[model samples]
Target: MATWAQFAAAEPELAVYGRELLREEQGYAFLATVSPGGAPRVHPVVPFVADGTLLVSIAVNSPKTRDLRAEPRYMLHATVGDNDTEFAVRGCAREIFDDTGTKWLRAHRELNVIDIPLETVLFALEIDRVDAAIWDDGPPHRQTWRAPNG
Candidate 1:
């Protein structure tokens, strides 16, 4: 898996477009996780990039949190606006247990006016793959990146 920085390094243009899409429209994204019964669960999430990592702060009691804890694999898709542009990332989440890391993420969240409660869990979404599609007049432009050995 690759950190956001690594993905950016590998595919600069796609990374920039993906970041723009992800941060657009209130920074909302759809996170897909696997339930304990092996069902797919999708939830809206506010995602941010901190310390070269894509992270999300989820309520500790949220069902998505439980799903993530039980199964780390996830697919996060940027919420499309009026356009046909699309961006998505597939990865595995790692829970943040270190106080310093969580504190840094919390501070960043606060700076962005993200209202994450204190009773929340932070997770790093390590990227295994990223895909993007941009449409204008003709055929849609598509791009994809995969982590080395991921």
Candidate 2:
């Protein structure tokens, strides 16, 4: 298992998908999870990468959210560029609707208009592992790491 710090250092290309990139490519994220019957379900969603965890606020009535709650294990696939320079990670998720989660959701009004229950658990992903690809040799770089709760 690679530590988050090691992943960050090895996958320098991920820097291009930081928060600023979220504003433009946020909608391209694919949230994939397994259904109760062992079927596959994948949907396009906006994701926020904060505190080393990824967040996607779903409506209380969303089928995906329901499926996710039942099965916290999921994979998020995000890509940029024609060469398919993508990043994918599988992690457990839990819903978040608490005041704090709601506040975070509200701060980003552009995300959605759902009232977002205040009891939602923050589907926090510890990022056990990640797979990333870089198609070009533009330059060697590193992404700015956001301190947790900073």
Question: TM-score per candidate, in order?
Answer: 0.93, 0.67
Q: Which residue segments of model 2 deviate by more than 4 Å?
A: 1-23, 110-122, 137-150
Error of 2 at 16 (Å): 5.3
Instruction: For candidate 1, write residues 2-118 as lDDT tens digits.
Output: 999999988888888888888835368999999999999999998888778898888999999999999999999998744679999999999988986667666766776666676
RMSD after CA superposition, every candidate: 1.4, 6.2
* N/CA/C clash count, model 1: 0
Tens digit per residue, CA lDDT, model 2, 1-150: 332344455555563443333433445677788899989999876776543445776766677878887888787777454555556666677666556666666654545553455444355444545555555667433223332331
lDDT agreement with native, every candidate: 0.87, 0.58
Q: What lDDT does model 2 reach?
A: 0.58
- Model 1 clash pairs? none
Displacement of the residue 7 alpha carbon in candidate 1, Å: 0.3
Query: How good is model 1 by TM-score?
Result: 0.93
